[model samples]
Target: YIDLYNENHMYWVTADMYFKANQMGLLDPETYTQKNEDYSQKINEGQVFYSSMEWDFDAGNAELSKAGGKDKFVDIPWADTAEFPAWISRASEFGMAARTFVVSSKCDETKMKAIMRLFDFLFSEDGSRTIMNGPKGITWDYDENGVAVLTEDCKQKLKENPDYLLEQGANRYLGLVGQDYDALSATQANEGKYIDLRLNKEYVEENMTDADKDYCDFYGVDVPLEVSTKRENQSTIHEGYINLMPAENPTDIQRSITKISDYLQQAVPDMVFSETQEEYDQKYAQIQAELKNMGYDDVTAYFKEAWENAISNYKELTAK
Candidate 1:
């Protein structure tokens, strides 16, 4: 569960109530069969809030509430919550079943593929357009130029600020199902403009050094060119070499990398979710010892060779 500070109230709570409800077996296949009927009742009863997993950041609340809250709100909860089963309660109260899934880096490829397919169906042209876009010539209309232009008053309201559109149902970019390429491109373009303006003000001085001026000039060309040098260097090295070289002498690079990675992986979960620092340290030492016993020296030599090769290639490339 996560907690947030509401403006009027000191503490407001947010949590993965939907997932929790599903896990508790509050929803079943029978409930799923009557979803629409259930949803209609809930909406009529004013018991439903349109919440989505995409609502990760606090800004999502603004979108959900149509920017109802005051400015400068603070989120209180650091993790998902168990208390307020809002989604589940609404679903059950309205007689709808809920199915929940957790998607993260740890999820297997099969699960990811299934999730992706579900999203694609929901966000496809026909699906989203039918459900979200409202009837023709009403919420949105087409221009003479054949662009999907919102009506004048609606456009004016949205144009009051770009973020207004984004917050209030700009599902084109924020939808879960498909990649909104046009929205993505527009966001990138806007970001580039902001970056260029910031760079012009901060780094583009008349009396700047040649190196600084050259760097600024290069940025004007294309960001990819500047990134290519870094990418080339990275491609030559075993990824493990970067972390291994940071440890003390006689330490194996591969072993050090493994130890550190394992330590961090375990430490984060323990410290954030389960145990105290003392408990984490106890497990961390055992992991380090195991890494050492697993031929850390040989791993270090392999990493060193990779690093040397990378460095040599970088030097040769830069010489030109």
Candidate 2:
């Protein structure tokens, strides 16, 4: 709606970034026609410097290890500016907490209690270790600091064959109790090592490629991930926007919305293609008038109103 992105000006912020790039002649001329896959390919071929969704740390590291790459790529946290506060998008699966469990109405209270016990154990330190690593003594154990550590034999096997962890029966993800196998699983065991043996500091160091070592030195980190760890403060997530869609689904509004979207898909590129900043500004100002004539105001108003109601509803729901 009108206010859908008004509060944060996310709509304009994105436009400004892209348009500024265009004004500077920094954007690729083929930008509008290129697909996400093309972006990924560019990154893999070392033709890209920045792309938010092009790939993650793992993929970048792996792809950049090719013969000519020299492994120059590394994950760095995106810092926020006063004008643009950044946010980390969360995985929808991790947010699906309530959707992960259910029981039949016909189930007895005893069965319900048993199910709860199962959840409790799954969340317990020992159970979490079992779920993430394997039965403790079999694959891992606690050290003097009471942190989870992979047994020497397990480490040796992993060193010899990377797939050894899979054979030891790890990451049966269906049984997780709202968290992943690393932080919580290991943190509960007295804040020792990562529950996933592969993520342990020693294992990671032992298994790191020469490129990983170089990145660690280049970033002044003892481990390659230290860069991200130090910059964790820069990352944040806000769940507010997840359910802010307009509640009403009137066909006419939907049509108007679709029309505006389709128009902007072309109009924005036209604005970016403008040869001069003055021309771009003129096009932008003209767009406001054209959008109003195309029912943009009415559609925005409906969605803005719906967004307000959705916020109110969300507040009430959370309060309960």
Candidate 3:
């Protein structure tokens, strides 16, 4: 079939391709058996496959490239057809607004002043550093030239486990209220603060490990992971579908999405391992036909209208 590399089969591709993999006997035993609870743990135990079906764009890309002895890999988009809307090509300079609010009723004169001072510090360079690395001379400190550096002990812990220092209450002053990224979804712990606090690019680079510096040099980025992700997001061609879609989806739409996701989870492995091209195509067609039966047409129509409206709204605001 295609010269696909990663064979872990953990990351999902299309439903048809996945089903074909299972059919062709290409899927790992554990993929069907559900024995491995953690993909990273499986890799650590030497159970890694040849290629990945999907991965996180930031951390996953760099880590995989380094580990797989590959200089680079391209991110391929998933679509039923090659034809896509022109809006997909358009990049917006706008970003999600980081908001702050105050309770006017709760503020006395002194409380109002304190709140104002806090915001003032939060928006400053020093404030950003404080939020990112914590109070100076503790976990992190600045040199004579003002580049942030982690303490020796802090650096040691970071090398052992990425979250070791965080677990020890070092750099924990920022807390949940001040965290920049969504804490629940974030992989790297303290790194999220760099994006939220708008840490200086140079400051971030100064703290990068030698390996990370090499990674940056090869990738043409001046900063480390968190800053790199922020820069990429800023330059992204289109907003993510998740961001544009309704927060509380309609019941039918939710049901359709769940059905499609569940179906693909089971069907993709089989499609990927199909015995022959003819078999693969037959399975593909069957999957597409089945998709329609699973209310895909209704879901697609709903998203089409929603996406068009989102695009229109974005354009209207940008025009202003």
lDDT (10s digit) by residue, model 2, range 1-320: 22432424656556667778877767878778888778667666656665445244345555555454556565554453544433422223223233256689999999999998987776565665676776688788888987678888887786676566667777655356444544424344343355466665677887777778887887787776566544444443323434445535789888888888898888878887888878877887777777787787788777777768767876776677
TM-score of 2: 0.60
Tens-digit lDDT string for candidate 3 (72-119): 333333232323211212221232222334467866989888887886
| Whole-model alpha-carbon lDDT for candidate 2 | 0.64
lDDT value, residue 88 of candidate 2: 26
| lDDT tens digits by residue: candidate 1, 1-320 | 12111212212111223223444654332332457666556444434434232223234334434544332222222222323211210101111112223478998989889987875655454333323433335445545964443456554654465454344444443334232222111223333211111122221242243433455455442332222222222222222223323334444554566765665454433322313446544654554465456555566566567668655664564477
Q: How close to the true structure is residue 145 of candidate 3, measured as C-alpha lDDT?
A: 61
Query: lDDT for each of the candidates?
Result: 0.38, 0.64, 0.52
lDDT of 1: 0.38
Q: TM-score ranking from best to worst? A: 2, 3, 1
Instruction: After the best TM-score superposition of candidate 3, give how far the Cα of residue 165 lies from its true spot, in angstroms.
Output: 3.7
Model 3 per-residue lDDT at 140: 71
Of candidate 1, the 10-residue stretch with the lowest lDDT total is 88-97
